[model samples]
Target: MRRQAVSPSCQQLGRPRSGAASRRGVLSSAAAVLLLAAGQRPSFATLIPDAPVVGDCPECIGEVNETLNACPLDAPSCISTLSDDEEHFAAPWQFDGTREEAIEQLISIATGARFDMGLIDSFGGVRQTDAAAYIAKGVLAVVSGGDMPEQPKRQRKSSTEFVPFDGDVTERRTTPGGAEYVRIVLGTGGGGATQASNLSEVIDCEFLFLPDDNIVDVRASSRVQPEGKLGSGGQLALSITEGLVLDKNVAGRQVERLRKALRWDVAPVLTDFNPAFNAEAPVWFERLFDPFNRRNKFQPSGLAYPAEGEGEERPLRLPARE
Candidate 1:
């Protein structure tokens, strides 16, 4: 695991930050799988015309299998982990929700049951929550006070946008295409890294309500190609996001079965001993990370991104609008 970051600066938003999007694995009869952004066993089988991709390897799977076999028995539940990105700090944190409410709220924060959200900080070291928190922490609480698109009429969206959190830096840019473009900051690295950058990079990304599957998948890969030819720069990198979906049915079934056995409100499976909240979900591994497949109605998270290189991330020169 990497060293924990100290007093990292929070990203300014119009969208979420791009940090460590990984997952862990657990062995299964057919294949290994991880939850969240990491993806299903074979999400993207990029052949590169004739070049080899991740699927071209065999030993990788074996190494992953051995790792899952060693997953710790102790794990935390959604409540504790939720405290970070979600914080149901509304006094009575945990809930004894009705079946319908449970399903609705489950859709809101459920991780593994559906291949929609990130891994269980357990799988490998994904730190899936960072992406959501990057936005939730910085935007959700403040968007209402901003001077831009009033939160979309739709409560559930895939991505949205905002101006730089910095006031003086709020000089907006109008796209050549006659559209509006917003600026924001993104976290360089965390889970414990240095502070966030004061100098914001201008990219065309959006704020979104990504499907939990967007962060985790068992039957697919979740990756977005940067809009340019080569890729992002070394100085200030840029990232494209891909998402996943959970078999809501499968997740519900498992929760149902566990509910019957444990007779608990929400299943205890979400609990973890050494609970990790960030990118520690061990995304690389396939099993511990891969979500048990079933089916669910995945909603689009209104996170936004630039339209191709229309507003790709570029290093700010005018001493960030601070």
Candidate 2:
């Protein structure tokens, strides 16, 4: 994370300062002392604390230092290659909080958006996507949690790790550091995917929390091939890797509004290690019809579309990873 000092002027804006600034500052001195006594740190826009781990995560337990140290700086995209299928990529991000916080934030951000209909719209080509809308929505969801009775339920329950969308088989395993990991995979072209289908698309994603490392590993492969064509070599594969800081202190009615838009249920998905999944009917259904759950209008940027006659093109297959 980049480090910079906050200027006194910036900190004092809107609030009365206690130093030798003005009469208001002198009057606020006692209030400042009370705040300090209460253990409240003055807000510093540029200041962020060191990443802290809370629980034992398999991949992070023994490798905290190495993982945090290896996380790449924020960039338009990651330099590390994800696979060898002549198609790979990496996309990393920097955040303001811990790894667990980042994971929750990512879920909130990704699910809050309207599903990208490839060929017409995409979240990538970051050039066209609205970063503020994405980040703001996620922050609101986290801050509001289950407080808004009007908030919509964004997630559905799923007992089986692998749902029919990615594939029927979701796999769980231990990483090198013994961290619990969930993998969702889908493949349809040649000898790659398990479920046999003619569609030439593949999605492989791994979700894990590195509590020890204070990192969330969201790595995946997205590939596409020409339909009904044999080894056309027109496959497009991109690898994505992201590291984010999550802020747990978000609060405000804006978050409640966002929760309604995302359809997120405040109920915990995993209770004491048992997943509620969509096995039982949702506990709260009032938010679905809430007038406040307004959908955002989306306009797709054509960056994801291929040039005319690029190959025997197939419709894009978006991943539905939890």
Q: Which structure among the candidates has the greatest lDDT?
A: 2
Residues 59-145 of candidate 2 have per-residue lDDT tens digits of 111223213211122211111111111112222223446655554544433333332222212333332235445566667877988
Off-target runs (Cα >4 Å) in candidate 2 are 1-87, 93-169, 173-180, 186-199, 207-322
Candidate RMSDs in Å, in order, are 27.9, 26.2
TM-score of 2: 0.24
Q: Once model 2 is optimally superposed onto the true structure by TM-score, how far is the C-alpha of residue 119 displaced, in angstroms?
A: 16
TM-score of each: 0.13, 0.24
Each prediction's Cα lDDT score? Answer: 0.23, 0.32
Q: Give residue 158's error in model 2 in angstroms.
A: 27
